[model samples]
Target: MIVKTKAIVFSAIKYSEADLIVCCFTQDVGIKTYLLRNILKSKKSNLKTSYFQPLTQLDIVATNKDKGTLEYIREAKVLLPYSSLHTNIVKSSLVLFLAEMLKNCLREEEPNPILYMFLEESLQWLDEHEGVGNFHIYFLLRLSHFIGFYPDASNMKHDYFNILEGNFQETKTSEYCLEGETVENFKHFFNISVDDISSIKLSKTSRANLLELLLTYFKLHVQGYQRPKSLSIINQLFV
Candidate 1:
Protein backbone atom coordinates (compact mmCIF):
# COMPACT_ATOMS: atom_id res chain seq x y z
CA MET A 1 0.00 0.00 0.00
CA ILE A 2 1.28 3.44 -0.88
CA VAL A 3 0.96 5.90 1.96
CA LYS A 4 2.09 9.47 2.41
CA THR A 5 2.30 10.79 5.94
CA LYS A 6 4.32 12.73 8.46
CA ALA A 7 6.83 10.62 10.38
CA ILE A 8 9.08 11.13 13.37
CA VAL A 9 12.40 9.39 13.01
CA PHE A 10 12.95 7.13 16.02
CA SER A 11 16.17 5.28 15.33
CA ALA A 12 18.14 4.36 12.27
CA ILE A 13 20.63 1.50 12.02
CA LYS A 14 22.83 0.57 9.11
CA TYR A 15 21.56 -2.76 7.80
CA SER A 16 24.43 -3.34 5.39
CA GLU A 17 27.17 -1.46 3.61
CA ALA A 18 24.66 0.03 1.19
CA ASP A 19 21.31 -0.03 3.03
CA LEU A 20 19.74 1.35 6.21
CA ILE A 21 16.90 0.07 8.37
CA VAL A 22 15.01 3.11 9.62
CA CYS A 23 12.25 2.92 12.22
CA CYS A 24 9.74 5.76 12.25
CA PHE A 25 6.48 6.60 13.96
CA THR A 26 4.19 7.74 11.18
CA GLN A 27 1.02 9.72 11.60
CA ASP A 28 -0.76 7.48 9.03
CA VAL A 29 0.44 3.97 9.95
CA GLY A 30 1.81 4.37 13.47
CA ILE A 31 5.16 2.59 13.71
CA LYS A 32 6.72 1.59 10.39
CA THR A 33 10.25 0.46 9.57
CA TYR A 34 11.58 1.41 6.16
CA LEU A 35 14.56 -0.05 4.39
CA LEU A 36 16.40 2.57 2.40
CA ARG A 37 18.30 0.57 -0.17
CA ASN A 38 21.65 1.94 -1.35
CA ILE A 39 21.16 5.19 0.53
CA LEU A 40 24.75 5.15 1.67
CA LYS A 41 26.33 4.10 -1.63
CA SER A 42 24.37 6.18 -4.12
CA LYS A 43 25.64 9.74 -4.30
CA LYS A 44 22.72 10.72 -6.51
CA SER A 45 20.07 9.63 -3.99
CA ASN A 46 17.84 12.29 -2.46
CA LEU A 47 17.54 10.41 0.85
CA LYS A 48 20.58 11.64 2.70
CA THR A 49 21.72 10.44 6.12
CA SER A 50 20.89 13.90 7.42
CA TYR A 51 17.20 13.19 6.76
CA PHE A 52 17.11 10.28 9.24
CA GLN A 53 18.51 12.02 12.31
CA PRO A 54 16.84 11.23 15.60
CA LEU A 55 13.42 12.86 15.97
CA THR A 56 13.76 14.64 12.62
CA GLN A 57 10.20 15.18 11.40
CA LEU A 58 9.60 14.29 7.75
CA ASP A 59 6.82 13.90 5.21
CA ILE A 60 7.34 10.58 3.47
CA VAL A 61 5.90 8.74 0.50
CA ALA A 62 6.24 5.05 1.23
CA THR A 63 5.08 1.54 0.36
CA ASN A 64 3.87 -0.60 3.24
CA LYS A 65 3.91 -4.40 3.34
CA ASP A 66 3.39 -7.11 5.97
CA LYS A 67 4.17 -6.48 9.63
CA GLY A 68 7.61 -8.09 9.75
CA THR A 69 8.75 -7.09 6.28
CA LEU A 70 10.57 -3.83 5.59
CA GLU A 71 8.54 -0.97 4.10
CA TYR A 72 10.21 1.23 1.49
CA ILE A 73 10.17 5.00 1.15
CA ARG A 74 9.83 6.49 -2.32
CA GLU A 75 10.60 10.03 -1.18
CA ALA A 76 11.06 11.99 2.03
CA LYS A 77 11.47 15.68 2.91
CA VAL A 78 11.86 17.47 6.19
CA LEU A 79 8.45 18.63 7.31
CA LEU A 80 9.56 20.92 10.14
CA PRO A 81 13.08 22.09 9.49
CA TYR A 82 14.90 22.55 12.78
CA SER A 83 17.64 25.17 13.07
CA SER A 84 19.40 24.09 16.27
CA LEU A 85 17.87 20.84 17.57
CA HIS A 86 20.78 18.77 16.30
CA THR A 87 23.55 21.29 16.86
CA ASN A 88 22.76 22.85 20.24
CA ILE A 89 24.27 20.76 23.00
CA VAL A 90 21.41 20.88 25.45
CA LYS A 91 18.68 20.32 22.85
CA SER A 92 20.72 17.62 21.17
CA SER A 93 21.08 15.72 24.44
CA LEU A 94 17.35 15.97 25.05
CA VAL A 95 16.74 14.75 21.49
CA LEU A 96 18.90 11.66 21.91
CA PHE A 97 17.36 10.74 25.26
CA LEU A 98 13.79 11.40 24.16
CA ALA A 99 14.35 9.47 20.94
CA GLU A 100 15.39 6.39 22.90
CA MET A 101 12.41 6.73 25.22
CA LEU A 102 10.00 7.02 22.28
CA LYS A 103 11.60 4.07 20.51
CA ASN A 104 10.94 1.85 23.51
CA CYS A 105 7.36 2.92 24.20
CA LEU A 106 5.92 3.53 20.71
CA ARG A 107 5.35 -0.04 19.51
CA GLU A 108 1.84 0.07 18.06
CA GLU A 109 1.22 0.01 14.30
CA GLU A 110 -2.14 1.81 14.44
CA PRO A 111 -2.71 5.46 13.66
CA ASN A 112 -2.83 7.79 16.66
CA PRO A 113 -3.30 11.27 15.29
CA ILE A 114 -3.46 12.81 18.77
CA LEU A 115 -0.19 11.29 19.89
CA TYR A 116 1.48 12.12 16.58
CA MET A 117 0.42 15.74 16.73
CA PHE A 118 1.54 16.03 20.33
CA LEU A 119 5.01 14.77 19.48
CA GLU A 120 5.43 16.82 16.32
CA GLU A 121 4.30 20.07 17.89
CA SER A 122 6.17 19.54 21.14
CA LEU A 123 9.47 18.92 19.39
CA GLN A 124 8.97 21.97 17.23
CA TRP A 125 8.30 24.02 20.33
CA LEU A 126 11.45 22.73 21.94
CA ASP A 127 13.38 23.69 18.84
CA GLU A 128 12.07 27.25 18.86
CA HIS A 129 12.56 27.92 22.55
CA GLU A 130 15.39 28.65 24.95
CA GLY A 131 15.91 27.83 28.65
CA VAL A 132 14.50 24.33 28.20
CA GLY A 133 16.45 22.75 31.02
CA ASN A 134 13.30 21.10 32.34
CA PHE A 135 11.79 20.25 28.95
CA HIS A 136 12.46 16.51 29.09
CA ILE A 137 10.88 16.13 32.50
CA TYR A 138 7.79 18.00 31.39
CA PHE A 139 7.74 16.16 28.09
CA LEU A 140 7.90 12.72 29.73
CA LEU A 141 5.17 13.51 32.21
CA ARG A 142 2.86 14.88 29.52
CA LEU A 143 3.62 11.85 27.37
CA SER A 144 2.12 9.65 30.04
CA HIS A 145 -1.24 11.27 29.32
CA PHE A 146 -1.25 9.99 25.75
CA ILE A 147 0.28 6.64 26.63
CA GLY A 148 -2.51 5.87 29.17
CA PHE A 149 -0.68 6.45 32.47
CA TYR A 150 -0.83 10.12 33.35
CA PRO A 151 -0.59 10.57 37.08
CA ASP A 152 -3.77 11.39 38.93
CA ALA A 153 -3.45 14.97 40.13
CA SER A 154 -6.79 15.04 41.98
CA ASN A 155 -4.99 14.13 45.19
CA MET A 156 -2.07 16.49 44.65
CA LYS A 157 -2.38 17.68 48.21
CA HIS A 158 -1.58 14.20 49.48
CA ASP A 159 1.80 13.45 50.95
CA TYR A 160 2.65 10.48 48.78
CA PHE A 161 2.27 9.60 45.11
CA ASN A 162 1.74 5.95 44.33
CA ILE A 163 3.64 5.28 41.16
CA LEU A 164 2.07 1.94 40.37
CA GLU A 165 -1.46 3.20 40.94
CA GLY A 166 -0.85 6.50 39.10
CA ASN A 167 -2.48 8.45 41.91
CA PHE A 168 -1.82 10.06 45.24
CA GLN A 169 -2.48 8.75 48.73
CA GLU A 170 -2.22 9.75 52.34
CA THR A 171 0.42 7.08 52.83
CA LYS A 172 2.99 5.24 50.75
CA THR A 173 1.79 2.23 48.77
CA SER A 174 5.10 0.54 47.98
CA GLU A 175 8.74 1.22 47.27
CA TYR A 176 7.49 2.95 44.13
CA CYS A 177 6.13 6.02 45.83
CA LEU A 178 7.14 9.70 45.92
CA GLU A 179 7.28 11.85 48.97
CA GLY A 180 8.86 15.06 50.36
CA GLU A 181 10.39 17.39 47.77
CA THR A 182 9.90 14.96 44.90
CA VAL A 183 6.13 15.10 45.25
CA GLU A 184 6.31 18.86 45.50
CA ASN A 185 8.31 19.20 42.30
CA PHE A 186 6.08 16.72 40.47
CA LYS A 187 3.07 18.79 41.46
CA HIS A 188 4.48 21.96 39.92
CA PHE A 189 4.82 20.23 36.53
CA PHE A 190 1.08 19.52 36.36
CA ASN A 191 0.29 23.21 36.81
CA ILE A 192 2.46 24.35 33.93
CA SER A 193 2.88 23.89 30.20
CA VAL A 194 5.91 23.15 28.01
CA ASP A 195 6.65 26.88 27.55
CA ASP A 196 6.88 27.37 31.31
CA ILE A 197 8.93 24.31 32.14
CA SER A 198 12.09 26.33 32.64
CA SER A 199 10.42 28.97 34.73
CA ILE A 200 10.28 26.57 37.65
CA LYS A 201 13.86 26.58 38.81
CA LEU A 202 15.35 23.38 40.15
CA SER A 203 18.69 22.65 41.71
CA LYS A 204 20.85 19.99 40.13
CA THR A 205 20.08 17.50 42.87
CA SER A 206 16.36 18.22 42.74
CA ARG A 207 16.29 17.86 38.95
CA ALA A 208 18.09 14.52 39.18
CA ASN A 209 15.72 13.28 41.87
CA LEU A 210 12.63 14.30 39.88
CA LEU A 211 14.00 12.70 36.74
CA GLU A 212 14.62 9.46 38.61
CA LEU A 213 11.11 9.56 39.99
CA LEU A 214 9.58 10.07 36.54
CA LEU A 215 11.61 7.22 35.02
CA THR A 216 10.57 4.97 37.89
CA TYR A 217 6.97 5.94 37.32
CA PHE A 218 7.34 4.97 33.66
CA LYS A 219 8.80 1.58 34.56
CA LEU A 220 5.95 0.85 36.92
CA HIS A 221 3.25 1.87 34.46
CA VAL A 222 4.59 1.08 30.98
CA GLN A 223 4.66 -2.65 30.28
CA GLY A 224 7.83 -3.93 28.58
CA TYR A 225 9.44 -0.48 28.84
CA GLN A 226 13.16 -0.32 29.53
CA ARG A 227 15.19 2.57 30.89
CA PRO A 228 17.00 4.51 28.20
CA LYS A 229 20.77 3.94 28.15
CA SER A 230 21.38 7.59 27.23
CA LEU A 231 19.76 8.66 30.52
CA SER A 232 23.04 8.99 32.39
CA ILE A 233 24.52 11.16 29.65
CA ILE A 234 21.44 13.35 29.62
CA ASN A 235 21.59 13.73 33.39
CA GLN A 236 25.20 14.84 33.24
CA LEU A 237 24.43 17.42 30.59
CA PHE A 238 21.60 18.83 32.66
CA VAL A 239 23.90 19.24 35.65
Candidate 2:
Protein backbone atom coordinates (compact mmCIF):
# COMPACT_ATOMS: atom_id res chain seq x y z
CA MET A 1 0.00 0.00 0.00
CA ILE A 2 1.39 3.36 -1.00
CA VAL A 3 1.20 5.79 1.90
CA LYS A 4 2.44 9.28 2.64
CA THR A 5 2.77 10.50 6.22
CA LYS A 6 4.86 12.43 8.70
CA ALA A 7 7.31 10.23 10.62
CA ILE A 8 9.76 10.67 13.44
CA VAL A 9 13.03 8.85 12.87
CA PHE A 10 13.65 6.48 15.79
CA SER A 11 16.80 4.64 14.74
CA ALA A 12 18.63 3.64 11.60
CA ILE A 13 21.04 0.80 10.89
CA LYS A 14 23.26 0.07 7.91
CA TYR A 15 21.96 -2.69 5.70
CA SER A 16 24.53 -4.48 3.51
CA GLU A 17 27.04 -1.92 2.20
CA ALA A 18 24.78 0.74 0.74
CA ASP A 19 21.33 0.12 2.10
CA LEU A 20 19.82 1.24 5.41
CA ILE A 21 17.09 -0.05 7.69
CA VAL A 22 15.19 2.94 9.05
CA CYS A 23 12.72 2.58 11.88
CA CYS A 24 10.24 5.41 12.19
CA PHE A 25 7.13 6.23 14.15
CA THR A 26 4.68 7.55 11.59
CA GLN A 27 1.80 9.77 12.46
CA ASP A 28 -0.54 7.53 10.49
CA VAL A 29 0.89 4.09 11.17
CA GLY A 30 2.51 4.27 14.61
CA ILE A 31 5.71 2.31 13.82
CA LYS A 32 7.21 1.24 10.49
CA THR A 33 10.62 0.19 9.23
CA TYR A 34 11.76 1.09 5.74
CA LEU A 35 14.51 -0.46 3.66
CA LEU A 36 16.39 2.18 1.71
CA ARG A 37 18.45 0.60 -1.06
CA ASN A 38 21.80 1.99 -2.21
CA ILE A 39 20.99 5.17 -0.34
CA LEU A 40 24.50 5.76 0.94
CA LYS A 41 26.11 5.36 -2.49
CA SER A 42 23.73 7.60 -4.39
CA LYS A 43 24.83 11.11 -5.30
CA LYS A 44 21.60 12.42 -3.77
CA SER A 45 22.31 10.53 -0.53
CA ASN A 46 22.97 13.68 1.47
CA LEU A 47 19.29 14.56 1.58
CA LYS A 48 18.25 11.01 2.42
CA THR A 49 20.77 10.65 5.22
CA SER A 50 19.77 13.96 6.73
CA TYR A 51 16.15 12.85 6.97
CA PHE A 52 17.15 9.67 8.83
CA GLN A 53 19.01 11.40 11.62
CA PRO A 54 17.89 10.67 15.18
CA LEU A 55 14.51 12.32 15.79
CA THR A 56 14.39 14.03 12.43
CA GLN A 57 10.83 14.76 11.37
CA LEU A 58 10.08 13.89 7.75
CA ASP A 59 7.23 13.77 5.29
CA ILE A 60 7.64 10.38 3.66
CA VAL A 61 6.18 8.67 0.62
CA ALA A 62 6.42 4.92 1.15
CA THR A 63 5.01 1.47 0.50
CA ASN A 64 3.44 -0.20 3.51
CA LYS A 65 3.04 -3.86 2.61
CA ASP A 66 1.59 -4.72 6.03
CA LYS A 67 2.89 -8.26 5.49
CA GLY A 68 5.33 -7.96 8.40
CA THR A 69 8.09 -7.20 5.92
CA LEU A 70 10.34 -4.17 5.59
CA GLU A 71 8.63 -1.30 3.76
CA TYR A 72 10.28 0.81 1.05
CA ILE A 73 10.43 4.56 0.74
CA ARG A 74 9.82 6.22 -2.60
CA GLU A 75 10.70 9.76 -1.49
CA ALA A 76 11.35 11.73 1.67
CA LYS A 77 11.83 15.33 2.76
CA VAL A 78 12.42 17.07 6.06
CA LEU A 79 9.23 18.34 7.62
CA LEU A 80 10.94 20.28 10.36
CA PRO A 81 14.51 21.48 9.84
CA TYR A 82 16.09 21.83 13.23
CA SER A 83 18.39 24.78 13.85
CA SER A 84 20.21 23.63 17.02
CA LEU A 85 19.40 19.99 17.74
CA HIS A 86 22.02 18.54 15.44
CA THR A 87 24.69 21.19 15.85
CA ASN A 88 24.63 21.55 19.63
CA ILE A 89 26.37 18.71 21.47
CA VAL A 90 24.19 18.72 24.58
CA LYS A 91 20.96 18.90 22.57
CA SER A 92 22.21 16.23 20.19
CA SER A 93 23.02 13.85 23.03
CA LEU A 94 19.62 14.37 24.55
CA VAL A 95 17.99 13.55 21.23
CA LEU A 96 20.10 10.41 20.88
CA PHE A 97 19.24 9.25 24.40
CA LEU A 98 15.54 9.93 23.92
CA ALA A 99 15.61 8.10 20.59
CA GLU A 100 17.14 5.07 22.29
CA MET A 101 14.56 5.24 25.06
CA LEU A 102 11.72 5.31 22.53
CA LYS A 103 13.31 2.54 20.48
CA ASN A 104 13.11 0.33 23.55
CA CYS A 105 9.78 1.56 24.96
CA LEU A 106 7.69 1.85 21.80
CA ARG A 107 7.49 -1.75 20.65
CA GLU A 108 3.98 -1.97 19.27
CA GLU A 109 3.06 -1.59 15.57
CA GLU A 110 -0.47 -0.42 16.11
CA PRO A 111 -1.23 3.23 15.38
CA ASN A 112 -1.21 5.62 18.33
CA PRO A 113 -2.09 9.07 17.06
CA ILE A 114 -1.94 10.75 20.44
CA LEU A 115 1.52 9.44 21.24
CA TYR A 116 2.73 10.43 17.81
CA MET A 117 1.41 13.97 18.23
CA PHE A 118 3.02 14.30 21.64
CA LEU A 119 6.40 13.22 20.27
CA GLU A 120 6.10 15.47 17.25
CA GLU A 121 5.38 18.51 19.37
CA SER A 122 7.93 17.63 22.02
CA LEU A 123 10.75 17.22 19.54
CA GLN A 124 9.98 20.56 17.94
CA TRP A 125 9.98 22.13 21.38
CA LEU A 126 13.33 20.58 22.18
CA ASP A 127 14.83 21.74 18.92
CA GLU A 128 13.67 25.30 19.33
CA HIS A 129 14.55 25.71 22.98
CA GLU A 130 17.92 26.36 24.60
CA GLY A 131 19.25 25.05 27.92
CA VAL A 132 16.81 22.15 28.11
CA GLY A 133 18.45 20.34 30.99
CA ASN A 134 15.19 18.98 32.32
CA PHE A 135 13.67 18.16 28.92
CA HIS A 136 14.31 14.42 29.00
CA ILE A 137 13.15 14.04 32.56
CA TYR A 138 9.94 15.87 31.80
CA PHE A 139 9.54 14.16 28.43
CA LEU A 140 9.71 10.69 29.95
CA LEU A 141 7.31 11.54 32.72
CA ARG A 142 4.80 13.17 30.39
CA LEU A 143 5.06 10.31 27.88
CA SER A 144 3.81 7.87 30.49
CA HIS A 145 0.38 9.46 30.07
CA PHE A 146 0.10 8.42 26.43
CA ILE A 147 1.66 5.01 27.16
CA GLY A 148 -0.94 4.30 29.85
CA PHE A 149 1.09 4.78 33.05
CA TYR A 150 1.34 8.48 33.84
CA PRO A 151 2.11 8.90 37.49
CA ASP A 152 -1.10 9.44 39.36
CA ALA A 153 -0.84 12.95 40.71
CA SER A 154 -4.18 12.81 42.47
CA ASN A 155 -2.51 12.49 45.84
CA MET A 156 0.07 15.15 45.10
CA LYS A 157 0.45 16.15 48.71
CA HIS A 158 1.69 12.71 49.66
CA ASP A 159 5.18 12.00 50.94
CA TYR A 160 5.86 9.10 48.60
CA PHE A 161 5.49 8.29 44.92
CA ASN A 162 4.84 4.56 44.63
CA ILE A 163 6.49 3.30 41.49
CA LEU A 164 4.55 0.07 41.21
CA GLU A 165 1.13 1.56 41.82
CA GLY A 166 1.84 4.60 39.59
CA ASN A 167 0.52 6.98 42.20
CA PHE A 168 1.40 9.18 45.12
CA GLN A 169 0.83 7.73 48.56
CA GLU A 170 0.92 8.76 52.16
CA THR A 171 3.42 5.97 52.89
CA LYS A 172 5.98 4.09 50.85
CA THR A 173 4.69 1.01 49.04
CA SER A 174 8.05 -0.39 48.02
CA GLU A 175 11.71 0.41 47.80
CA TYR A 176 11.10 1.64 44.25
CA CYS A 177 9.07 4.57 45.54
CA LEU A 178 10.82 7.93 45.96
CA GLU A 179 11.03 9.59 49.33
CA GLY A 180 12.60 12.75 50.88
CA GLU A 181 14.57 14.82 48.39
CA THR A 182 13.86 12.53 45.44
CA VAL A 183 10.12 12.87 45.90
CA GLU A 184 10.43 16.62 46.13
CA ASN A 185 12.41 16.79 42.92
CA PHE A 186 9.88 14.62 41.08
CA LYS A 187 7.13 17.01 42.13
CA HIS A 188 9.09 19.95 40.78
CA PHE A 189 9.40 18.32 37.35
CA PHE A 190 5.64 18.15 37.02
CA ASN A 191 5.43 21.93 37.24
CA ILE A 192 8.09 22.62 34.62
CA SER A 193 7.83 23.22 30.88
CA VAL A 194 10.45 22.99 28.16
CA ASP A 195 11.12 26.73 28.39
CA ASP A 196 11.24 26.76 32.19
CA ILE A 197 13.05 23.43 32.48
CA SER A 198 16.45 25.02 32.98
CA SER A 199 15.28 27.18 35.88
CA ILE A 200 14.12 24.11 37.80
CA LYS A 201 17.42 23.35 39.46
CA LEU A 202 18.77 20.21 41.05
CA SER A 203 22.13 19.17 42.38
CA LYS A 204 23.95 16.40 40.48
CA THR A 205 23.26 13.91 43.25
CA SER A 206 19.56 14.71 43.35
CA ARG A 207 19.26 14.48 39.57
CA ALA A 208 20.90 11.05 39.58
CA ASN A 209 18.61 9.88 42.37
CA LEU A 210 15.54 11.08 40.47
CA LEU A 211 16.69 9.29 37.32
CA GLU A 212 16.93 6.08 39.33
CA LEU A 213 13.39 6.60 40.62
CA LEU A 214 12.08 7.30 37.11
CA LEU A 215 13.77 4.19 35.71
CA THR A 216 12.27 2.08 38.46
CA TYR A 217 8.85 3.53 37.70
CA PHE A 218 9.26 2.62 34.04
CA LYS A 219 10.38 -0.91 34.90
CA LEU A 220 7.34 -1.49 37.04
CA HIS A 221 4.90 -0.43 34.32
CA VAL A 222 6.66 -1.11 31.02
CA GLN A 223 7.17 -4.83 30.39
CA GLY A 224 10.56 -5.98 29.15
CA TYR A 225 11.91 -2.48 29.75
CA GLN A 226 15.67 -2.12 29.91
CA ARG A 227 17.77 0.84 30.95
CA PRO A 228 19.23 2.82 28.07
CA LYS A 229 23.01 2.35 27.85
CA SER A 230 23.38 6.01 26.82
CA LEU A 231 21.71 7.14 30.06
CA SER A 232 24.95 7.61 31.97
CA ILE A 233 26.45 9.59 29.12
CA ILE A 234 23.38 11.81 28.96
CA ASN A 235 23.45 12.28 32.72
CA GLN A 236 27.08 13.32 32.63
CA LEU A 237 26.47 15.81 29.85
CA PHE A 238 23.57 17.40 31.72
CA VAL A 239 25.45 17.48 35.01
The superposed Cα distance between candidate 2 and the true structure at residue 40, in angstroms, equals: 1.4
List residue ranges in candidate 2 displaced over 4 A.
44-47
- What are the clashing pairs of model 2? none
Q: For residues 68-157, what per-residue lDDT tens digits would candidate 2 score against the true structure? A: 999998989999999999999999998899998898789768889888888988988988877787788899998888888988788989
How many clashes does each candidate structure show, in the order listed? 0, 0
TM-score of 2: 0.94
TM-score of the candidate numbered 1?
Answer: 0.97
Instruction: Point to the candidate with the largest lDDT.
Output: 1
**CA-RMSD of model 1:** 1.0
